[model samples]
Target: MRASRPVELVCPAGSLPALRAAVDEGADAVYLGFRDATNARNFPGLNFDRDEAAEGIAYARERGSRVFVALNTFPQPGGWRRWTETLALAADLGVDAVIAADAGLLRHAARHHPDLILHLSVQGSATNRAALTLYHEQFGIRRAVLPRVLSLTQVERLIDNVPVELEVFGFGSLCVMVEGRCVLSSFITGRSPNSCGVCSPAEAVRWEETPAGRQVRLGGVLTDCYRPGEPAGYPTLCKGRFRVNDITYYAIEEPTSLNVLDILPALVRAGVAAVKVEGRQRSPAYVREVTRVLRAALDACQADPDGYRPDPEWTGALDRLSEGQTHTLGALHRPWQ
Candidate 1:
């Protein structure tokens, strides 16, 4: 959907190069996390250190783009200092906003650093207008990233009532469970995307070549077994093929990307403040291509909302980069639910 006013395009950046790619390719803002447990996507060899983050901020500011630091992970009892220090660093670096999920951390930011823009991360799990309003009123959050579990109707209604700005996922890998609340990964691996900043940590994954084919395991438990010529996906518990009622299939959700190109008009009419592309763990090249395609699509939608159609070339490019080489409307389309 072409909006009456231009909506911001928020892109992800796991590294400095990805940050540069996002801003250079027309992203209005690039979000990244520090290289620590305070942020999600705490995978090895990803994210930025203090120097790198400062460099990234400088690059974005020079390009007339904003930078958001993701201090989105919940800290454990003894780890409050890490989050607080990270927030201090972000403020010193002059970031545009901080995406945070923990209540205590939000309160701290509101009390100690009132000038910093606070954005409620999807990890906060604030799906309803009331939930969002509580965050806005309590912590003075300027925006909230909605969980990817709502239909367009629900999103539209929430936007009309919520006190703060709303950012919805435009394109990304689909999470079967509710964001920030899922514990399936934690049960299997002692790490989680919420607290430890990892889901299915690499150390917990095992791949074995079996007589039947190839077997993938998470925490040494069988998740899926793929035949020789078939595509085997990453070993996450939710996207794993399992047996139920004598059927071997994707019991939770399949490994498909979320593509909302057809629903941009509806989102625009619904008054969405921003559309976020979710791929901080992806390669810089992937970030560049995805940002470019979405930027063009949004422009095209604005040029002629009534005549807007999904560009085949754009769809093909995203599909080629998507997990399982496929994409879906996800929870945005009611039927997908």
Candidate 2:
């Protein structure tokens, strides 16, 4: 692995309280979105409004935490105006950076706000060094949020070759599909993940009691039918059980969280610039707990790379707070098995 300094902890803040909690618990930076289609996490009753966003930015800045606004989703044909306007507003708010995926919007930001720092979102699927370098060369993107599909070795290679900074998903819910390449949600519903800013819209989920036990469905497709004693997980299409070759299996990914607390040192040595925590829909309490634990772990690693070992208690704490029935390193170590 290509070793580097300790990586920055860039966490998610879906709401004002979560923003405050993240900063207080020791997040170096917080990434959030406006409550609109311009952001990928465009769920109802989530995300910040203009006033709330400004307040959250100020709150984070006062506590020495940087704020990055996500303008990651591709714009709809006639709805390009909304994304453009949101970018302008984010720049006006003095956010430390803006996470963007669309090429056109990146061009607009590069032209209009030359000094505004741009971080390429993983939604752009910049997996390789060539693609990452191209974005940096063309749009002056300072950092790239790499797709989750790359292994640690691959990330080390990309980091070695790419000129821009690299951010990887350190801990989060693993999306089975390649980042920026998933169309499963859109195939079932009219909404497109890239353009509509949602994968499986919450409104499309359905659950009911069945003769076997409980059946969970998404967009009228049976996702998983659980026995009476089995733990029920959220019905996202990727994590749902499906059949292939006459054998029922999890076609995409099993319902699992990505908890990489133990692998902090390995990731730090892999030339990663930032470590992202992916839970915009989680509670502020979850933000606080996870941030506090990871912050300490990173601090320990920075203090003594050779002597560092993540606290077993903190790892347990994160696992307890995680959703689904299990957690794993996902594709970071190897291909999802």
Candidate 3:
């Protein structure tokens, strides 16, 4: 079936160049954050500062693309002012919208920046119609990005039931933790994922050679070990291979990326308002290529809904960019679901 509307292709803009890359490659909108703890993806040298954000937003708007500033992290009691300031900055800079999760912050945005478009971040953890409805009714959120844990059927049902627009992840690295409820990173690192954006903060990671293999540890806890010639993934507690019950394996979740190109038609039919490419910590080249591929695929799907099939070259390109050099449908089409 043809999409009810042309789904917005939202991409990441970690830097100015990444923003330019996505806009040039046909992203309908590009989301970013400030270079502070007020937003996620707060790794050193990753996000934008004030001047940089203004420039990036101008660059995107001039090219007919929207800019969204992510103020998605929850604020601790004393530090809440920073979050409020970030929201104000986004509005002052003429940002197209701001993606926020915290109910208090959302209320603040609605009360103070009432004209600004509000999008409930995936961190808001609204997995049901009631939650989506509540956010929409209370704060007037224009859209909500769903967490990746939901199945296809659930997404379709939510779309049918909810009044707000829905955006789902169509590409990028998969997260093992429940969205908005991450504590695994906090327990080991002495930093909450809310405050520290890095899954395994680089400074705390140590890779060493062991008699068994190459061992990668996060904050001194051995997370994964690999034999010679084995490609090690980015160190994270959830994707780690650990010795559980005498068998060393990836007991929690294996490393992989999410690619939904094959199911584009289904998403369109389900009335998805947007499909996002999730990588703000990735490189400029990564953003350019992934955005290019998805733009082409979305266009092709729109052109030939009944006959849409992913091109082989497009599949290969996305696979090369995927985590661990492979991709899956993720939870969208999971048989177990």
Best by lDDT: 1
lDDT of each: 0.91, 0.86, 0.89
- For model 1, how does the per-residue alpha-carbon lDDT over 240-303 read when each residue is reduced to its tens digit? 9999999999999999999999888888778888999998999999999999999999888877
In model 2, pairs of residues that clash are none
Give the runs in model 1 whose Cα sits over 4 Å from its true position.
1-5
Give the range of the ten consecutive residues with the poorest summed lDDT in model 1: 1-10
Evaluated with TM-score, which candidate comes out highest? 1
lDDT of 1: 0.91
Write down the lDDT that model 2 would get. Answer: 0.86
Tens-digit lDDT track for model 2 on 236-257? 7888888999989888777888
Residue ranges of candidate 3 with Cα displaced over 4 Å = 1-4
Instruction: Evaluate model 2: give its TM-score.
Output: 0.96
Clashes of each: 2, 0, 0
RMSD (CA, Å), each prediction: 1.6, 1.7, 1.7
Error of 2 at 320 (Å): 1.2
